[model samples]
Target: MATARHARPKELENASLEEIMDRYVARYADRRADWAAFEDAKIEGYKRAQHRFIGAGGSGKHNDVSAIPAGNFTLSIMYVPPGQGNAAHTHEVEEVFFVLQGHLDVFVQDEDGRKISKRLGPWECISCPAGVIHGYDNNSLEPVYFQVMLGRGKPETMGYADDDLYKRRDEHLKAVS
Candidate 1:
């Protein structure tokens, strides 16, 4: 006896944004419908802490999530502990930062190595261009909550000069400690 062959369903073949969003929401709802699994995920998300200690430079903590490819952006949620800062660094791509809390002093170096600095407070945002040497210092007594979005570029491609070392090791140590 010959077996009957069944036809396969076609793919979405270009769904609209509304359709995609509706499907995504429905999928999340289904995943969250499982009480135990949802709760476990929430707990795990809260418990996974990541920190980078200061060596010759500075230290801070970060909580990063795998980024989506929708807008060619990488998003990170980071917390700079009070009195901690990053070593002078720069990136080869444009980046945007939104300060959700606390204050930060950003020092930037231009093409000729001339340094310029500015202070950022809560709700402040800055757009940093590519190839500019830059780094941040936490000037507040509390941890700063911030989100950073980077464009597609190897951050290491930007040139850096460790001019901030003197600021950290010499002038700021007594003040910070």
Candidate 2:
């Protein structure tokens, strides 16, 4: 009478404890720093790096074999330098940012482009709903480190506010390795 949700996967069910741990555990030192910018970040002011830990974490690197397999969501550590940030964009699923260090000026916008900004320091967080345009800036003197998560294990590429960027959103996909 056990349901699939409660059943152990065949791959893990027969594996040794060490094998299970090897497949599930992701060490921080082994993570790769991927700076594969999204379409909008190709602009002069927007740039950042993503250290993938689980799934692609919305960077569209779904083929990254080194990352721990994601179940329901994706996770990554974002590094944003001073005066740099992401442009307004939206995804098919909700996105969350939990600031781990430095200050990030985050904002969310309505359909008409009306936006509200807030300064988030360490331990602060924000959840941007699906289809809402949101972004962040590192106005502080130092770089900002933050954890990012997306609702889906492999969400679609984000939709940029700018027509050009939106049109080229999938360009980053081809460049991802």
Q: For every model shown, what is its TM-score relative to the native structure?
A: 0.51, 0.91
Question: Which ranges of candidate 1 are over 4 A from the true structure?
Answer: 1-71, 111-113, 153-177
Clashing pairs in 2: none
The positional error of residue 99 in candidate 2, measured at the CA in angstroms, is: 0.4
Q: For residues 29-109, what per-residue lDDT tens digits would candidate 2 score against the true structure?
A: 998777764666666668888888889877787887878888889999998989999988998999999999999999998
Task: For candidate 1, write residues 37-124 as lDDT tens digits.
Answer: 1111122221111121111111111111112222334444456666655545566677666788888777777657787888898899
- What is the alpha-carbon lDDT for the whole of candidate 2? 0.86
Alpha-carbon local distance difference test for all models:
0.47, 0.86
Question: How many residue-pair clashes does candidate 2 contain?
Answer: 0
Deviation (Å) of 89 in candidate 1 = 1.6
